[model samples]
Target: MSDRRDVWITGIGLVSSLGEGLEAHWTALSTPAKPAVDETTYAPYVLHPLAKIDFDQQIPKRGDQRQMEPWQRIGTYAAGLALDSAGLKGNKEVLATTDMVVAAGGGERDQTVDGAILTDIEKQPNPEVFLSEQLQSNLRPTLFLAQLSNLLAGNISIVHGVTGSSRTFMGEESSGTDAVRIGWSRIAAGTSEIALVGGAYNAERRDMLLLFALKSVALHSPWAPVLADPKGVPTGSAGAFLVLESPEHAMARGAKPIAKLSGVWSERAKRGEPGAIEALVDEMIRTAKGDVSEGTAILSAACGAPEPTSAEVAAISRSGLPVRSVTDRVGHSLEAQMPVALALAALAVSKGKLFAPLEGETLEEAFEGTLTRAIVTGVGHWRGEGVALVERVD
Candidate 1:
């Protein structure tokens, strides 16, 4: 670790319920208003759907546009934004060598087929046979192929001409933590020069909603901050990506970095291990190389799920740094959570301030001065916990 080069966040591509890109999100966040959440669309379970996206802006070809599922499209679009932000878009020479690591969930479910089978279940004497028959007949091979998580990385390469070493991770929230971690590790170690990393998640599917409900974790009340939520984690749709490159690589091309990705550490502890998360947070702090200072702020990826959130709150409290949860503004996005928090932290540090609190969360404190460093935390709703440090290069 001592012989490594500095890793910088040269570009960020992020889209969530709040807005698109850094400027739009920063503006919305800084405004003194309640977090924008939809309680009626999904009823009891809240959702933060993405703002309208003009697909043509990123995915240009009509045929190419039609092939990708919603999540793939979202990731592809955000990847383009990150490439553009890093001043690498359409630069064939630079892109030819850019590495990519993506964290993504499974493809969208064929809901119509699933619903028809369910409704016809009682009509058949052998429900299991009928279910099996419908699944085989109704699901197209193309749709089946699209379900592979790596298709997102493939789609980005096909559309954006980023034909480099591409890697995709598929764990829930931890997938996000590892995606950035791996990409940053490569650049810092100088084995590779620059890399694109991040993840995307679509929570709009009935199947996904059902998945959460089966676990009894879906929020069933009005929307509020992660700290204020009386229920549990609500679902949301978001996609985030970042262009991480070695400092030397960036300076050679005159790419001004948004922030430096100083360090990233991830851990998975058993949920059954009571009080394990507090120690996980401490482990993350210890891994950060101890540059935390008065100018540092913490952007929490605290899922509104009760137990984990409570533990994260206590852990962050022990650090005594000013804090805010982007999850408070945007609902919980499983695979995209870590990168989204990192993107927000990069934007906040680049602009030198934290956003205004959405009102009602007592843990939030407005940053008093310019942000020189930030600790981005992710305490997964179910099993994993991680934290990352992004420092101002100047």
Candidate 2:
């Protein structure tokens, strides 16, 4: 650890229900505003739909755009924004070696095909044969290809020209945490100079709704702040990407550091055991909290699931830091949750102040002091736990 180089966040691209771009998110979070939610579309479940986006600005090719699904398009566009923000958009020299780490889930299911198969399969004589036939004939060849989780990274490479090594992690919220951690670790260890890391999720799909419904973790009609609500997670559509580079590399390119990614710690707690999450969160926070005195707060990605949210709340209480839940504003973007929180944390440290409390004054109190450091905490709705430290670059 002592030999590690300082990793810096040189660029951030975030697109969510609040809006697109850094300025838009800052304006929305800093002001008194309600989260943009759609309660009727997937009733009685609620979700935060993506704000209007102009994909043309990022992915200009019509053929390229047509081939990708909504999630891929979102990720590719966000990656472009990060490259632009880092001053590497057209710099083929730099992009050719810019490694990428992506956190992704399988592609959206074809609900029409799924429904038809279900309806007809029940009446067929040989269910196995009928099912096999339906799968081959009903599903398009391109759909299977689109479902590969690594396509997000491949599209980003093709669209943005980031030709370095590519790695994709798939495991909901934990994948997002590891994507950032791996990228940071590689740069700090001197194995890589720069990396692009993040994830994207599209929440407006019946198949996903059903999947979460099976777990009984889907939020319902009466929406509430994440910390206050015990009703499950209300997923959101979002894409977040960060450009991470070593301090020396950034300086050599004249790229300004948005904030310093000092440390990132990740763990998977055995949720079946009581207090596992709380213990891991406590230890991780203490470890990542090294030497910081004042002007610090926490940006938490506590999805509204009962157990994990409760455990995270208890941990945050013990830390005594002014904490705000990212889920309260953006809804729970499973794979993008951690990256989104880190991006906002970095943005806050750079701006020297934390945004206003997301909900009522009780759970999220106002932070009036100058912000020099921000701790981003992510307690997965079910499994993973992670803590990341983002500090001002002096």
Candidate 3:
């Protein structure tokens, strides 16, 4: 392990309800303010809407912008921001070999088409036939093409020119966790000198709300801190990406590291079995605790879903580390959750402090000491569990 190259996080691009870029998010989270929530838009279901952003600033060509879906646009825009942050934008020489890993879900649904079919199918005598006909007629070939999960990587490559090896992972929060893990592992193993990794989610869709509502995991009106109200998750629109580089590579490019990525570990637990999640979480924390001395806290991506949230809380209490739930501020971003948590963890370690705790959350305690390292934890709403250690470079 000592012989492995040290991996550092040099650039971070984060866009959430708090706003875009690191400065905007840091200021908003470190201060005393309410989470940007839209309660009435979804009616009975709460969500964190994305802030208005001028697409031209990041994605210049109108033609390029028009072809991408909202999620793709968000990802491409964030990827550009990360390249710019690392001083790698338009650096054709470096970008030609930079690897990219993306975590994403399927494309947004055509709500109008879906609505029409649902409304009309019930009235038809032959409901199955009507549905089949509608599906064949209403769906466009282009719409199906847009649903490819790898398109986010393609768009980033086209717009940002990161033409290196590309990989896309699709599962939910686990995908985001694995994306970061693989990117860091590659850099540390000397297989890749630099890599871009992250994911995005658009939570302002009725289809997404309906999907969660079906599972009864969609948070309703009157948004409360996720820790205080561990009943359901309020999805938020967000995009998060990080530029990871080996120490040698970063120094060669004169890119300063914001924080050191010490380690990343991921696991899956059988939720049907009692103590399964708790056992994995405890093991991960025990392993991560070996990397720090003191002044370490946890940044948790514990979505407000009841089971996982409670399991994560028990593990945090056992670890005896002060913790803050990232979901409380940004909302549950599904595939983007782990990347968002890591970005914020790196930001916190770089600044030497943790952000303020949510107003009504009794579980989150204030940390008055310098933050030397942060352990970011992501317990998937249903299946996956992961943890990563982020520490100050110096």
Candidate 4:
């Protein structure tokens, strides 16, 4: 009865290392290929860099573009694409009421300032005092203001005029899972007629790479698919956003659905505890709506962390469904991880066919037939696990 309201996915905006738009992804993935990676630049670490994009196409103002960080620009561009795809970009009536939910991390670091401070620290006898003084003198007044995570939502409101209520979530991968889940729940509950939900990540930062590498969570070169690696995730630069609306609203607007989102469930597992992740994933899957027996494939957001990946693989094996890790192709996008997978699911269901398997055997069963449903699973590198069941509209 709760799911009777029927939440529909009407528009999706996606940009990744593979490329942008639904067609680019589908075309590349349909072929047997490996993920695009940069082995020498990061040296010893692999990264999936974003494809070239003309920012002026989506973000017209150079001033607005200059003020925001790369991640914000990526998110703003993707948001514009989503609104355009949903036929709501310039519809002031609809834009005025369309809610926005963004999942994002803290802003990128000011590496030059950081470097200057570190360089100056060693020259002072009282390093603590020097550190404080340098931060005060060198950092720009606007630097701190620019780092707020909610700026993504604010920029979206300003750029696209999506002036409805806005919200932002901060936890890594789980943040993305909850963004979509909350959007769908609000739409289905009739509290919101329509919403834009998703996130983005900029992996081309020295600070980011170092931060992740410190945790030993960055994949080294001589790259391998997510499931194949036991070391860490190969992070990528990507932005994904989706337009979700109630079935009634979509029909009233004459906007056809790309897929139907039945339900989503999420949980955080206490790591280092055996069986914790397995049990968490199993429960999330069981709680989701739609017929599990009809699932065509599991689009896994397994972030290639040794512990979580192994446990996710085990849990999904029990579902007896073919599984393909999105990280295998695009690498992990942290907060954008789940949203990207959800977008991929919508694309797959709309086509009514599954893409060729990246890791064939476990997910190798050929379905030379129409596809109707896909189960999306997101297992965080360290903490969360989420599952969603999506069905074809036709």
Instruction: After superposing candidate 1 on the true structure, give the runs of residues whose Cα lies further than 4 Å from its correct spot.
Output: 116-143, 289-291
Per-residue C-alpha lDDT of model 3 across residues 1-394, encoded as one tens digit per residue: 8878899999999999999999999999887567999999899999999988888999999999998999999999989888888999999999999999999998888888877877888899999888778768895524688878899999999988999999999999999999999999999998999999999999999988988888888999899887766888989999999999998999998999999999999999889999889888989988998855479999889978888888987887788888888998999999999999999999999999989988888778788999989998888888899999999988
Clashes of 3: 0
List model 4 lDDT by residue over 158-253, tens digit each: 899999899999999999999999998998888999999999999888877877787888889878876655578889999999999998899998
Clashing pairs in 3: none
Task: Give the candidate number with the greatest TM-score.
Answer: 3
The sequence of per-residue lDDT tens digits that candidate 1 reaches over residues 1-394 is 6998899999999998887899999988988687667778777788888888998999999898788888888889999999988999899999999999999887877778767776889899998898778767895534688788999999999999898899999889999999999999988888899999998888777878877777887877677677655368877788999999988889899988899998898898777878888888866865663755668888888888888888888887778788888787777888889999999999998888877865788888766787888899888888889899998878
Compute the lDDT of residue 190 as modeled in candidate 3: 89
TM-score rank order: 3, 2, 1, 4
Quick one: RMSD of model 1? 2.2
Query: Could you report the Cα RMSD, in angstroms, for every candidate shown?
Result: 2.2, 2.2, 1.8, 2.4
Off by over 4 Å in 4: 115-143, 289-291, 359-365
Clashing pairs for predicted structure model 2, backbone only: none
Instruction: State the lDDT of candidate 2 residue by residue for 1-394, as single tens digits.
Output: 6999999999999999999989899999998577899999999998999999999999999889998989999899989988888999999999999999999998888888877877888899999999788768886634688888999999999888999999999999999999999999999999999999999999988888887887998998878877765579989999999999999999999999999999888899988899999999988887877667589898888888888988988888788788877888888888899998998899889999889886552578888999999898988887899899999999
Rank by lDDT, highest first.
3, 2, 4, 1
Candidate 2 vs candidate 3, TM-score winner: 3
